[model samples]
Target: MGTWGTSIKDNDAFADVYSEFFDFYNKGGQPEIISKKIIEDNWEILEIEEEKNSLWFALALAQWETKSLDPKIISKVEEIILSGVDLKIWLSLGASEQDIKKRKIALDKFLEKIKSDRPKAKPRKRKKLKTPIFATGDCLVFKLSNGNYGGAVVLATDNNPETAYNLVVTTRLNQSNKPTIKDFQNTEVLICNFGQWQDKADVTWYMPDLFYKDYADIYEKIGKISVDLEYDNKNHDGKGYLFKPSWTACWGMNNAADKQFESELTKPKPKKTLTIKQLTKKEKWWKVF
Candidate 1:
């Protein structure tokens, strides 16, 4: 979350890394210039976006494909194993379960090969969150006890869900009548597109059926709903969300989506049909056939 979060703002560098990663994959699985050291040095940038999952796993795959390995390379491989990124997320990158299994085996063997050369370091494991970190631009779908369903875009994420749930969601509803992060239950969270909110005038509430049907393919299961993420008025003597006085009514959300909502809702314009008079004689004659 340090420098890794900031450096990906450069679109050029992002595109280069993305294309180079694919190119490296195509030419050979071996990492010639993009060694473990290079990845380690630029770790902040590489792991900046959601692409971090892909970047880490790709390195693992490339390492496995390389024919020869030195102690230094093995050490770097070890660093990858110790990195907190989950190897399973590679599945989301189109890797099959069998391939992931082989990758794990290869990683294990590589680690064993270098055991004598370097002492084993403690593995850095990621904490199993009650709910996965709901980062900005994530999609959230919920079905409450009332049996209604709807979804929204995550405007921001709260790393620590203990003290306060830091979910700032951007909905289709106007800023005046939007649901706070607390107003959900039996929630089903999905890792949708890397989209953000933009252009307030464009925001409007979308019915449940329309949304799920339209964007059905992009959603992936990330985690479950937190039972108590929303603040309860009963618990804090009628204090609202985040225990702030201003949040006592209408929750803390206000015109949050007015600024903008950058999402995948841009529908393509329909192709215009040619009128009979506008068509050439030859084209019209062919159409008759």
Candidate 2:
């Protein structure tokens, strides 16, 4: 139900699988090895029918694109396509006749595309990103607009320098007054909420090198405060928004979009939304949902 459309690439399960495969491949992992690793990593999902189909579909596509398609994987994908279980699931889920027709065509097209040989995309030498710019729990302030101070706290840092990034969240720093270190602990995480999650947005990033060169004299390290990011999650129908703990940079957010975020977040506004309450209500940083 995470799917939004009939396209093979339209679901979160497919996006997660395909992207992870390429992440490993681009980092110099072998296709066969990466494929096996994905299979092993998602063993639990493999037990479910729809998820099982998504796995095969995604892995077959990735392997085909890399010119390392496995015979067994292709066979599994072919069976899933011909079995029409995906469309059946769609029908069971109340998909209209028109939607079911589109899904059927999508499945056929995917099968044909993977059967054809694709030019191999060569893996490049990757420079794993730099070490996290700030340590976990480091609260910092930056002067973005004239005379305005914006606050952010490092929520977490990764161990691998290649993928290590300082995951930070912006705080509700009012436009006119500078907040005391203790005030930051009371401030809410600034977020763009528009009823549904599809309308949610955020600006985040590791400390880019330009931080010193471009934002020099504006960045200040404040006293540390503990924080865990609360993300907006959408329902299957994309109708409702749910606040969940988000601990990684991979959440859908624009890198270095802080300047734009500051425009609205730095404005003086009373807290009335759900994220602050959710944070205080039995929320654990590591909880996935």
Candidate 3:
């Protein structure tokens, strides 16, 4: 819907549909199956008549490149183009006469490209899987800002070296002395609720970056749990994973591997709290509450 240019890839829907098609294709999905799934998954895109053009154009281009162009898809695009419905929609969206002319030219070129036969199909690429540094049941410990230590358990891994991350639960053992392997297994995890630390609502993070064996100066592997995972699974003891874990993730790391734990150890995230004096700017406002 957000159209900044006249090119097929200029629109948001086109880029999304095109990328998804290739993603499934690279994963060894059959072209017909991938096309159907893409249509089903993004059925909403087809609802808006204006947006429908982007999806069909993207799908057509992808299919053409893969040498699997479908007649029905080509026919749909052709109908939209020749009928001039796309240009009318553009005019409705307040496009200039010049821009509409350019879009029509682009559409004609696109139709010609897809209607032609490709000499060869583009090769399907293999998707690289991410692998985790620590195992599912591994116990980990990291230093906190107050010279105390924080505990964590590696609940699961998505087997990706970079992307698929480690699923971990931080423990509540904020301690000054170093804890042994036994301590990690016995302690309760930090649970957040109503923005404060407490009950049923908790946080489980997907961390692509983590402290590895080399970063033992600040973080280290203590041991493993899970007679079969989940640190809270009642199958292990009595308290299973009853809490609904809130999930979050971080993005755009330059080098997640070498710098994950090292950066945290050197400069950890600071926790700043405002005391009454700081809040009152050191004034005698204790009676103002």
Best by lDDT: 3
Query: What clash pairs does model 2 have?
Result: none
**How does residue 161 of candidate 2 score in lDDT?**
53
Worst 10-residue stretch by lDDT in candidate 1? 1-10
Tens digits of per-residue lDDT, candidate 2, 115-168, equal 987877545546556565677667677653346666766655655655555555
Candidate 2 ranges beyond 4 A from true positions:
1-3, 125-289
Predicted structure with the largest TM-score when compared to the true one: 2
1-289 per-residue lDDT for model 3 (tens digits): 3223565555546766776788788878888999999999989989976688888998999999999999999999999899999888877755557768888889999989999999998898766555565777677777654566666666666654435555655555567888777776667644332111223322243433322321335457777765343333223222334444433232111112112222334544223222211211223568578
RMSD after CA superposition, every candidate: 21.9, 12.2, 15.9
Candidate 3 least-lDDT 10 residues: 250-259
Alpha carbon lDDT of each predicted model = 0.34, 0.59, 0.60
Estimated TM-score per prediction?
Answer: 0.24, 0.50, 0.46
lDDT of candidate model 2 versus the reference: 0.59
RMSD of 3: 15.9
Per-residue error (Å), model 3, residue 134: 27
Superposition TM-score, candidate 3 onto the true structure: 0.46
> How far off is residue 45 in model 2, in Å?
1.3
Error of 2 at 243 (Å): 4.2
